[model samples]
Target chain A: MTVTSLPHDAALSARHPGELGLRESATFDRATIADIQRAAATGVYDIRGWGAKRSVPHFDDLLFLGASMSRYPLEGYRERCDTDIVLGDRHASKPLHLQTPVTIAGMSFGALSANAKEALGRGASEVGTSTTTGDGGMTPEERGQSKHLVYQYLPSRYGMNPDDLRKADAIEIVLGQGAKPGGGGMLLGQKITERVAGMRTLPVGIDQRSASRHPDWTGPDDLEIKIGELREITDWKKPIYVKVGASRPYYDTALAVKSGADVIVVDGMQGGTAATQQVFIENVGIPTLAAIPQAVQALQELGVHRKVQLIVSGGIRTGADVAKAMALGADAVAIGTAALIALGDNDPRYAAEYAALGSAAGYYDDFQDGRDPAGISTQDPELSSRLDPVAGGRRIANYLRVLTMEAQTIARACGKSHLRNLEPEDLVALTIEAAAMARVPLAGTSWIPGAR
Target chain B: MVTLIGTETPAYVPAASGATATLVDLAESTVRDLNQALHEPHVQGEWTVTNSDGKHSIAVGIDAPVSVTIEGHVGYYAAGMHQKGDVIIRGNAGVGLAENIMSGTVHVTGDASQSAAATGHGGLVVIDGNAGARCGISMKGVDIVVGGSIGHMSAFMAQAGRLVVCGDAGDALGDSIYEARIYVKGTVASLGADCVEKPMGGEHLEELGQLLAAAGRTEQPSEFKRYGSARNLYHFHVDNSTAY
Candidate 1:
């Protein structure tokens, strides 16, 4: 075979049949080849952290339609375009009034370092938003640092307590996550420290599998009763949020609303997880941009559109993404992977450490294996101490502030005073797929691809 | 003598116990009011609740060290998250009875629905009759004793606990169980993922005997079989994980 060095992005030239030539097969890319080889060497499929890396129609495919001659735009500096949102105003006696549309998503104390969990709490608190407790339950540092906290009632029920339920500003009943919908969560033994083990009531070092479905209830009817039970337990004070993976968002949203959810959190395919099978992460669930339209349609059909708040998540990074999500009829948006990055995860400064672990800084996805050099996803005392919660918290808070400001800027450009006022009319899609998924008109055209 | 509280219903307060016995009737009092009364600070008493009539969430979230007795059938989550209390339900229990309980003793006189004593931390749950599917699911450091048969998926993902079943067990008996000892006396239909029947040793037999005695059972400990994790998939070993 003949070998030639070419630019990374340059296309391979076709050679005559007589000449010695080979072209990289489109069906077998480098990643697929490597995966095949790896699977050949080992019998098991890969398990990794983070979300889907495959190319899909995302928020980047959509663009905001700024004000024109027909419409007037608000001044960027002088205009007071509000970003405030009210969650769980439907049935909750005391609803959460957030100053920003961005809230921190759930990441467990066991999956993350205590410092990282505290940092999330501190950051969300600083930004007048809420941080959630994940699979292993609430930690003292998180509860103390967070101004508004949302306790996740997951199927695992790890370290769940009634006192903590009362302590929370809101309660989120997690039915499924986006990364691995209808699949259980996996926490490998290496990350299970004594504290984590104690909190979860497991052995010091053991693999823990969080159940896919809830233990008690099998269907939506039982869910309605469970919600009632929770309301009665909390004296109808704390807002109840129901979260679901973005598979069948239309039906899920309708059922969640029927089950008396104050807020419906829809997590899409691009959502991050601490650990899951790579197959599930890539193959399962719909995209965030696609999930929102169906969820809104469901809520509209049920005649409870804004009464029960909608929070969309998965691959949300910048202010533009936040604005787009809201324009698609979401009341709020949640950030998980981006929030961890703001807390200094995958920083290039730890390049050497990551390399030693057979991975690079940008390529570090071994959160389940637990020897995270970044200190955010590990349980090692020495490694965990590398992170200062206060400093990390400040960084996250600043990032959140920037995201909020950026979203406000976009809202003002659309001539909308409040973030919620930015409707679907203020947006356009760059591609046919995006236009169809987002239910928005094509750029420089009046037609939405899939609209009847 | 019966005393009225806030013109709602007549509550029977036993004078013999010197304000220690507070009898509540579910016919007149709501579960919310009863739970509110239980949550009151420094409220120490033996709460005798009558006419439950299959109501859900009876005596839920009781934190105090009080004794609660439900005279009739109760519905789902009958002592859920109960902390430091002695709760006795005289009749059948619905789904998720004593779920997420922390440091308490809950007794169900009749049969229990699915997921009995689920995710409980540091508690003792005794069911006199058969338990439905997913009993003791995700149990954490809780001791559960069932007098009769238990349905499928019992002890699933159980982190740390002892599930003592005096009678037969259904399919997928200990699927994905973690470190929790499942002792079953009667027939076992099947074992689940990563779960295997381990030989019953002296310590296990003695422990089973003690649990049986605590559960007020006459079954011999020698008749039981113990099951637990095979320790595969502990660290994501490629070849070992193929069985999953």
Candidate 2:
């Protein structure tokens, strides 16, 4: 085959020998150019918070197929629709029973303030769902407030203790995160407070790099041994959840199941991070919309679908997103960035403070700096005092209520009694990418892009 | 408070101190049953687990300050996440021995497998024999001492406390270590990441001496070389990519 230059590239190359203007077919975009210049100016790679900013296939690319002439619709006001869910029923004596499928995602205390963590606990408790503790370990404030708490067992094992493990309602073994799969966690010196340092047994004001791989087990076989150890440690009382970034959901899900996990948590490309290299955040892992079907297929192929619960996270913003995720076979959905917003992370009310930080309310993503104007992601005492946990908890509770109600509304309109009953047949994709990923038909047609 | 005499099953002997002493024979009891009996509220007693048979996760999640002695070889994660207890393993231990321990003491009389005493906090762990790879990995405020040589990557990313290796250390000793002090009496194959050899100052000598005493070793502090963090990668810099 012959390689032919595009018209724009040919025209640009014709004048590039003396031109001061940018090339029409420039390989680097404005953002890429900025990143390159920044890297050249500062030797270190850029580290920040938040998930993939560039657009990809997402829930918005799909829509629900509402009841029409051929299908009878339920009365919206009189119909009853359920949104309840149960997790960890496989082996745990006491499983998690939630009023809704929406639950809080894991966010560490060091990355967030004590008040913010408390708010998450309170909000999740009010809705009869669960809240999770991230990398640094569980805090007293979080445990006292959350009705059901899931303790994260990361590769770092920071502050991991038997007492905390026993106190946890469930245990989540973190393999990786969506923002930076195959990458370690980073907590800059600025965020390491005295309490945080003491808890993690690190010196104050020192940067910490959590290990990417677990110290004990290496592969799936070793993982099975480790899972048995965890079960014995907890006396087979607490449920074990294996969480992984959605890079190879099918394989990861199968391995997790084989390792005797009671639940599987898949976080996709859009999952938020407290701090990480910007390149890893922007260019790692598959999208949530694409990860769900792969994970479901793995569970189904293993004959463990719904027997082992699946909780999908990453850029899940609304009740519509939750409904779509469940319709695609996710048992539940988790939220992090959106929950922070409910707790006032980037409220327009903090616009003046955001301006002082050289950013706007809606555009802020520098959670790693620990100078957050909204006080949600800071270790500074004065800044952390700005947030009120009680009020924040109330706001989050209201948001959760809205999401549950909206999901119920959709389920009723679809003539379904339970959210889990809203199957893939009740949905249609607006784009070929979403259609293929979700394994659903395209709008106004019976054609599926890549179905067997 | 009942003692069963020697019969077809093993005998349950009670201690003279009047504290309830529970005897668990692995030949007849399950790990779940033993752990459940140990976790009972207000059950303050001594526990002796016999015939461990190299089983993984023996005497794990012990919350109260109890004394537990294992008579034979134990498998992976032996005494894992132990707190407020004294656990003694009479035979060789498997991988991740005493891992993630908090506020407890785990004593292994024989050789230990990989990742021994990893991520422990507020505890003391003593391994009388050689330790495998990643010994004391990510240790936090937990003092660990290996009476014999240690395998590769000992004290990797250890955040605090002291690691005393009476014998030689394998390659990549103390890789990416932070704050934790390492003392090795024998040769070190290599250093890794941001780890380096540091001068054993007067304060370090005193500290090493104390760690040696705690680990029940009579070796001279001066005989060991001290290793610690170089503080090069403490803060992120692209120039430090080689260390990463």
> Which candidate has the top score in DockQ?
2
The regions of model 1 sitting more than 4 angstroms off are A1-22, B1-20, B198-206, B220-223, B238-242
Model 2 lDDT at residue A188: 93
Candidate 1 C-alpha lDDT tens digits along A155-190: 988889889999999999999889977887778888
Instruction: Assess each model's interface with DockQ, reporting 2 decimals per model.
Output: 0.61, 0.69
Identify the runs in model 2 with alpha carbons over 4 angstroms from their true place: A1-26, B1-21
lDDT of 2 by residue, B84-112 (tens): 88888989999999988887789999999
Clashes in predicted model 1? 0
| Backbone clash numbers for all candidates listed | 0, 0
Weakest 10 consecutive residues, lDDT, candidate 2 chain B? Answer: B1-10
TM-score of 1: 0.93
User: Considering summed lDDT, which 10 consecutive residues are worst modelled in model 1 chain B?
Assistant: B1-10
